[model samples]
Target chain A: MIYRIRTIAALTIREAARRRLLAALVGITVAMVGLSAWGFDRLAHGGALTSGESTLALPQSLILFMFMFSFVVALSASAIASPSVASEIESGVLMTVVTRPIRRGEVIIGKWLGLAALLAGYAAAVSVLEMGVVDWVSGYLPPNPVLTTVYLFAEGLLLLTLALLLSTRMSTLAAGVVGIALFGAAWLAGVVGFLGTTFGIGALRTIGRISRVVLPTDGLWHGAIYYLEPPSLLRAHSLGQNENPFFTRSPPSWVYLAWVGVWFVAVLGAAILSFDRREI
Target chain B: MWQASSAESDGLVAAGGVPQATAPGEGAATTGSPRPSVSPAIHTLGLHKRYRRTVAVKSLSVSVGRGEIFGFLGPNGAGKTTVIKMLLGLVKPTAGEAMVLGAPVGDRRTRRRIGYLPEMFRFQPWLTAAEVLRLHCRLLELPRPSWEQSISESLETVGLAERAGDRVAGFSKGMQQRLGLGVALLGGPALVFLDEPTSALDPVGRHHVRQITRDLRERGVTVFLNTHLLAEAEQLCDRVAVLDKGAVVASGSLSELLGRHSRVRLKLSAAPAGWTTGLSAFGAWRTEGEWTTVEGVDPDAIADLVNLIVAGGGRVEAVIPEHQNLEERFLELLQEK
Candidate 1:
């Protein structure tokens, strides 16, 4: 089983490394980080917010930048993962491996581990780079960098797993589109739930909760970002005040975190089972 | 329920003991033996497969002995691939049973003893030829010490050792096919299924592959070869099965199949124009200029024809025994249904 996993992982890494998508991902991530630094530098000069005020506001900007970086990383990771298995099957490369002594489930798991390793590496590098820039400009950094990085890596891993599962039944293009759409919808739903809870809208809050439970990408990201920022950022604003949701106090609860782990295992298990039964 | 029968069959010590027998019109004796049995390298009974509405394989049954080179021949889309896939457990049969190495098809244990080279093989373009072989070795759990040596030797066997470090992306179609075969032979599998193993090769490349296949056979490896290239099958196969439409049309040793549909062509010189009148007793006779052809030649007819031609003042040039080629037999079987 371990050998099968290693083989699949090696194959996946080789394939993913060859795609033009990885280069595009690196370019976009580096550009985003550079752009964020430039924007912060400009905001630093404006007297509208003092150095101390901007320093405090650094967490919000860092969280927002991380969110954007996550989007880029998730999109690229999912796009590559979506085709990694399906295209191999279509082109007959999978036949070379699957017909060997290895089990089908082992192939799927190995691929998952390989893609996860890649996404984890990307998530860690981008998060640390962006956090470093935020610290340099505003002298502010997250108290729990390790926890925040783990959460980010977990979010990417979850998205990759979902993309792999979808790829088993759908084409690569369709899987990528659906995976990204679900990621956006999950985040949107979580926001709606957050607003409903704060404004006493019970039904809307229930919808948000259900959406996050259904697809935990957004829920996990929100929790990770919230954990990285200061508690003061989440203080409720007045009716006329305009504030980003990054300033909301009600981050994902412990129950939602537990459910996210459960969701991860469930989706990954389903992906392996579906791949096992698939004809290749 | 299906699982129980497979387990029972696996426990049976008799070699090739499935109750289903080959169709009986050919008069070929069933070769059954009893000593501990190499355990039915491949077995299928009533194996039916369909794509939507068209049945690709219907009630196909065959059992291959261990360490035997079994040839599977058929026309295009004649269920040869369908049968091979069923044995590999790649495609599940709609109805029927397929067993490999005494285990259910697709079972990991059975697969460990089997290797496969699919027809129209395509490898991961990004992987080097050596990486591809090593990857397969890793999956097959061969020891690390043997992995590199086996990879090199397998490539050398396929004549791709020089291109071992090169990515498959730049490989020609024939080169890719060779590398695919190299991967299949990496771990020294006891049973190997090769579908058109030499389909896209130059004559020299084909020769090399045939030699490798022969070498495998000599090493006591059972080979189940599916090919439309009749000449290659004739050269290497010990026993063959011909499939038409979705069923086995005819099967047996080359000599046995030839015996059932024998033909003799006689080349005569200075034969009279009215030779056709005297040759009607033979099964089927045609005269193209000086070459008179007679098919399904019986010994009595040959003697009579020689006597008539000699008595009629025509000298007998040469009597040639024209055996039925696989292509002719294949067509005959197709027309039979």
Candidate 2:
């Protein structure tokens, strides 16, 4: 059983590699990392700022960069996974595969594992490389880098699961559009909730909370943003208010994390069930 | 060895008028007793499918014995593909039951022993031919030690041994079809379902598929073939079922279906003007000039026909016997339906 799944995952990875999509993703991500590193170096050495000021502000800048990285990861997950099954089925590629001794659920889980592994690995490596660059250039490193990467990876997995679920029932383009649109809506709601908390508006706060509960991408992004804040900003943000979208005041509650876990399983299960019932 | 018809194979065959094929060594053991396994390779009773109000298939019943080449014939909307899908468990049957390889269709163990080449014959374009074979080997749960040999043998069988390292994107439609056939033949499946197995092939490729199918039958493997090429079916099938409009319009061993209506064309001189009148007992006869044509003459009674004409005060000039080929019978059946 494990052999079949491992072989399928390996095949998926090989397909991605041979198609050069992996290469394109790597190239674009590397260029982004290089440009960000240069910008950080300019902030430290070429900008009008004292050493202490640059040090204090650089982690906030890194948080902003990390936010961009998180978006990139979410988008990648949607693009890579949304069409994975739907297109194969549409083209009759899965005809021979499903008729084999393997079950439909195995195919879905194996593909999910392949994409999750690729996306999570990409998220972790990019986060570490960007943090190291920030620390080297401006001498400012965020606390809990490992925890921050975990959140980003989980966020990618979450989006990937949604994309996969949609792939079972929709076309590649439709699934990707819906997946990414939901992610954007959740993030916008999170920002609105932050503003609502600052202005004492209850309705916007409820919308944000409900969106996070429904999708969890924004909630996971908040956890990642919280871990990227420097201690100084955390103090100031707490004193003033949670007015910024790039930095957060506290980590997500364990209950919310637990709910995210449940949500992950429910969506993955639905994907399997939907694919199982679908006439291929 | 080609009988031009399979009707005689029915007496020995125990399922749906298709004779059972003993395995390589089972013939020796069969002299003293019945074959150990009596289950037909495929057995279906009242199978059906529906998409909303549209009925894709209905009241489909068929039986195929082990080691026989069963041809499934049909028109464009005849539900042939749907039947194959239901038998392979790719589509859910709305009603009735079908058993394949001694178990229910879509059963895991049964599927493991089955191979399928779908009509489209597509694969991931990025993978090489050899990689595709290897992927199937793993999917088939073959041992690690056997994977290399199995992949090599399959590639060799499909004549893709030289192109095994090439990506599928570089393959032509014919090559992709050969590759699909090679994949279906892998793991030595006991039953293989081939849908339009030669639709994209050239003469050489079609010949290769025919040879491979014959080889599969010799190994006591049951093959269920679906093709629009009636000539190919005439040359390959032991028994055939003609489907039209989601139902089996005609079915039996080829000889049983085709042999019942064979034709005989005759040329005679010095025959009486009414000599052909009593020929109705022989068959449906038509006379034009010196020629008299008869249809539906049984192969066994053709000699009686010539004797009757000779006794009717005619000097027989020439007697030409023409058996109704599958294409003719297929068209006739469709037109009648």
Candidate 3:
């Protein structure tokens, strides 16, 4: 059984590595990384800012680029993970393998491990590259670079797991679209709730809290941002009215971290259950 | 030898086909009995399945003896694939019990001893043919030491040895189908369920599949074949079960099924005035332009009829015996139903 699961994992990874879409993704990633590097170089050498503002602007600008990169991660993970299970089920590619002596749980776990490994590699590469570019241009690095990279990978994984669960019952296209849409909505609600909290608007704050409970994707992204920005920048954003969507007032609480873990497991468990009952 | 290894794992097969642990030697002991009657390789009791309101299969009971090539014949929407799926544990039965090699349906250990090729399926196109076989070898838990040789032999058997290194993405539909067959034969399974194994193949590929299936049977492997091509079934099946709307309408050995509708066409140089009338006593007779057609004639009575013709002073020139082929019998069965 262990051998079977391992073989499946290896095949899954091998197949994923060969996808044309993955090549396209890497191409776009390279272009984005190069473009960001150029943009930061210009900001440093173009002489557009005072030294005092540059201190705050450097981290601010880096966080903004990080937001785009994180969204890209979420999108890429959904694109791959959504079709990994749902399309196979629809196309009947899963029939032969599942009929073997291996358990269904093994298949699910093997697939998850394969895709997670791929996404983890992607997240780490982009985060590290962007950090290097930032340091070269502005001599500024986030206080906790490793923590920020970990958080970004966690955010991508959370969305990927949700997409996988949806794929068990929905079409691949539907799962991908819905997964990304929920991720976007949660982030929007989090921003609106931050404004509500800053201005003491009770109803708006409630909406943000509710969205976080419904989907923790935005919460995870917020944690990544909290680690990526300097403490001085965070304090500045807090003292002023919360105008920046990328700014984090406080680190994610332990209870929130616990909830994220619970949510991830619950979604993965539900996916396995749905896949078990599903008829090909 | 393969049976012994499989049966050595546990107790006697559970009586009702529900999966349970078996004593290691009970399988061998039960099979070794001299009673002449033994457990079927594939057996189902009132198996049924429904997709919402669509009744895919209903009350399907069948038994395929060991080492026999059992063809499952059915038209479109006749539930042939559904039955195969249920037996292979790919689809759950709605309300009946099924057992394969005396193990309950979907039994993990039993699956190790079984091979299946679905009616419609696709392999991961990125993997080479050799890699696909390797993956299945691991899944089937074939001995690690023999993996390399087993993969090579399976590929060679399917006429795919030279293309083993080629990625499946470059394969034609027929080649892919052949690869699917190779995958099914990977572990030297005790029983193989082939659903439309020849659907995408050209004549040559189909012939190879038939030969492979026959070879498996010769080696004491039970083959449960599902196909719509009547001639294929007629040529290969030892016994057959015809399914219609999820039910077995007719089933028996090929000879038995065809025997009931046998006919003979006789051509004579000349006939006596009352010869047609006299021929009626031997069997049902009708006169076509240059022949006397005998319907439902017994094989032994053919000689007697020819001798009678000579006694009646008529010269018998030709006697052509025709047994109903599967197509005709299948049509008649459908019409009767």
lDDT of each: 0.76, 0.84, 0.82
Candidate numbers, best DockQ first, in rank order: 3, 2, 1
- lDDT tens readout by residue for model 3, B1-47: 12332332221232233323233344334444422125568666668
Q: Which residue ranges in model 1 land beyond 4 Å of their true spot?
A: A18-24, A46-48, A51-57, A191-203, A236-245, B1-37, B266-282, B288-291, B298-318
- Candidate 3's DockQ is 0.76
Q: Pick the candidate with the highest TM-score.
A: 2
The residue pairs in collision within model 2 are: B6-B255, B13-B19
- The candidate, 2 or 3, that scores higher on TM-score is 2
- Candidate 3 residue B125 Cα shift, in angstroms, is 0.8
Off by over 4 Å in 3: A20-22, A198-201, A240-244, B1-38, B267-286, B297-319
- DockQ of candidates 1 onward, in order? 0.67, 0.72, 0.76
Q: Tens-digit lDDT track for model 1 on B1-337?
A: 1232342333222222354432322111112221214346666667888889999987776767767788888888988888888888788899877666656677675576788999965887777888878777777788899888898899988889899999899999899889888878877788889999988899999999999989998998889999999999989987888887787777777776666566767777787666566676767887787687887766446778778878877778888767788778777877877
Q: Cα deviation of A224 in candidate 3 (Å)?
A: 0.7
| Model 2 per-residue lDDT tens digits across residues B38-145 | 556776667789989988886676767788999999877788889899999889999977667656677776677899999974899988999899889889998889
Write down the TM-score for model 2. Answer: 0.90
Between which residue pairs do clashes occur in model 1? none
Clashing pairs in 3: B10-B22, B10-B23, B10-B24, B11-B22, B11-B23
For model 1, residues A155-242, the per-residue Cα lDDT tens digits are: 8788899999998878788888898898888878878887787687999789887887798877677667767767555442334432
